[model samples]
Target: MTDRTPGFATLAVHAGAQPDPTTGARATPIYQTTSFVFNDADHAASLFGLQAFGNIYTRITNPTTSVLEERVAALEGGTAALATASGHAAQLVVMQQLLMPGDEFIAARKLYGGSINQFTHAFKSFGWNVVWADPDDIGSFQRAVTPKTKAIFIESIANPAGSITDIEAIAEVARNAGVPLIVDNTLATPYLIRPIDHGADIVVHSLTKFLGGHGNSLGGIIVDAGTFDWSKDGKYPMLSEPRPEYHGLKLQETFGNFSFAIACRVLGLRDLGPALSPFNAFLLMTGIETLPLRMQKHCENAKAIAEFLSTHKAVSAVNYSGLASSKYNALARKYAPKGAGAVFTFSLKGGYQAGVDLVSNLKLFSHLANVGDTRSLVIHPASTTHSQLDDAQKTAAGAAPDMVRVSIGIEDKEDLIADLDEALGG
Candidate 1:
């Protein structure tokens, strides 16, 4: 049967999936087996020896997970993708595949609190250093680049604060340095922004967010654009050089454009073992079908809330890219032209106490840590998410003591505004 090249919506519903040959099932069935039966000893040898691609174990790959991977790659306009157990796991997998001991990467200072901890503390043990650069200043990225710099990392739309990065500018710096630009597209997703289209070599996402909209599954994905030439300068020995473990096969030579994804799965996932569950993959696939719809509504609701917050007497400042006054508005227009996304922050006039009271008073918005959910959610970052960071670090990360992060949902704008009105003592 000839595969139809459909539009985005059509591809979302049918990509990397077809009716099961055995049962004629239209829905993707979870291949709940740990291992697949091989045809013969030679076939098994070829699979294990990297001569052929087939599922050897559930920990490395699975059929259900493969659908999710393919769908995400198609959505992000990447050559291939690998699904991981969590967003953090995806980051670890990418770093493990690319970075060696004493190598470094440049990252935007404004990032998720958990990500900051992961880069600063956890990755340090592995001898991977992160050079923090201000995303607002594109020149900082170029200045931060060193000989040991392997990649440039930034969020398309930063978490909590919702600052937008100038992806093309940063990618230019990475290109000049001969390093791949890695973008965490978790907030913007592919519906609003495809980093690969903006010159990002690798794009990562937390599927637990908008991609898995219902908050039922925890998953992540790393998508390779397949544009970067790993062998050009021999910066990445793992991909450019021969692998002794895989029978002297070089990834760049064998997989061609998709060498990065192959390395991430074969080496990173093979060693790290952070594969997404088949059940989670199925849930994530279901969620992706409605991604365009959900994302549109999310941006709409978020814009309304941000506007309201900006005008309110109690609000000291609003940090949404949709706002004209936002520092990121220009970049948001260039990169995320569809929308600036749902996650943003607003600071109250009363500082920390007011932030605490707003959360305590809200009736509709749930006070939770997670973002990109179907229901509206809020959090006082200084008291909760960034509590571990000291005053200086918190301010540097845009997590002020008075700031409250809101993840707007597909709810009635009037109702959401009214809920915040009462909470802010309107």
Candidate 2:
């Protein structure tokens, strides 16, 4: 290795990983176990107290998951990260650190359907309120903010719609409100957009999607940008206050820049117990190695297909940021000039029933609710993912009755287009 910083591709393959010490294995080996045997009593005590960083239990941490966390942190350019069982778990851990009962967080309305459901319903059960804001209008975020606002959440590239967000603009609102900005970079991935590079204090991902590349593993991560001043206004007590569990140690005072990650691990993950499996972590890490290669192909295939859909007679609209006519194209060029990403929605002239029929007719594209698989996938969001939302809510989330979303894979562009053509023709 040279003195110069490693490029994105190099980081994808080599960051946070090396030959196994036990067998000199080139690839990272899964440390699949429930607990670790400390060398001495003091060693175990130090680990349990967070005095030293070492594995104690799989529920809190594991060597395999640690590598995944470190690799994701390096890719996202965050100071530290925590791996979770799933993306929703990542959000839960993050919000747990920032919000108390009856507190609030501002969220962009344009988000993944699963996230919308989790924020609106699941968080409400915990007394954590969600204030919905329009990502298209930055002023909405500012107006939604109140004294109780703990954080602001937005997707880097919104799901289904593939629209670009004004992260810097909304980040300003968070800064003025003295709240951290949380950006879900699952759709864009770090390969396309590093939200931390553009004023994001925290970045979250559903590794089930592109990061895992294949539909083989389910995982999530929370990355601490190490830029937020959690102690400045004392808004986040989880970080700023003393902890009885760790013998009254103040996390922010103790861990400094990466305190947020530590808090999520010690307080949230340790108790909530949404631990990622070591085998899943191993698979996800392997998927990340070829992220640079897979992501580029995903983007290229997506842009071509979006172009094809734009011209199809059955299509009323194509909601892809890569398309020049899209409302988010200018922002895309500014934020993600590399490519727009793979998952995008298009409206059919035939509306709701047509959407269902398209998915039914498609031969190559599998009909599924999930996205970011190596195989092309299709879904009628209004009927499946966004079914819980009402008409107005569905429209707001960009999952209109007429919309059909597709996650373009690394397969041949012509084949994908032909499949879409045949489906629409039927």
Tell me which residue pairs clash in candidate 2: none
**Position 172, candidate 1: lDDT:** 97
Over 1-426, each residue of candidate 2 has an lDDT whose tens digit, in order, gives 567998999999888898987899988999989999999999999998899988899999998899999999999999999999999999999999999999999999888878989999999999999999999999999999898999999999996688899999999999999999999999999999999999999999999999998999999999999999988888888999899888899999999999999999999999999999999999999999999999999999999999999999999988899999999999999999999999998899999999988989999999988899999999898998778889898786677899998999999999999999999993
Where is model 1 more than 4 Å wrong at Cα? 1-5, 388-393
Clashes of each: 0, 0
- Model 2 reaches what TM-score against the true structure? 0.97
Whole-model alpha-carbon lDDT for candidate 2: 0.93
TM-score of each: 0.97, 0.97
Model 1 TM: 0.97
Angstrom error of the Cα, residue 21, model 2: value is 1.8
Q: lDDT for every model?
A: 0.92, 0.93
Q: Which 10 residues in a row give candidate 1 its minimum summed lDDT? A: 3-12
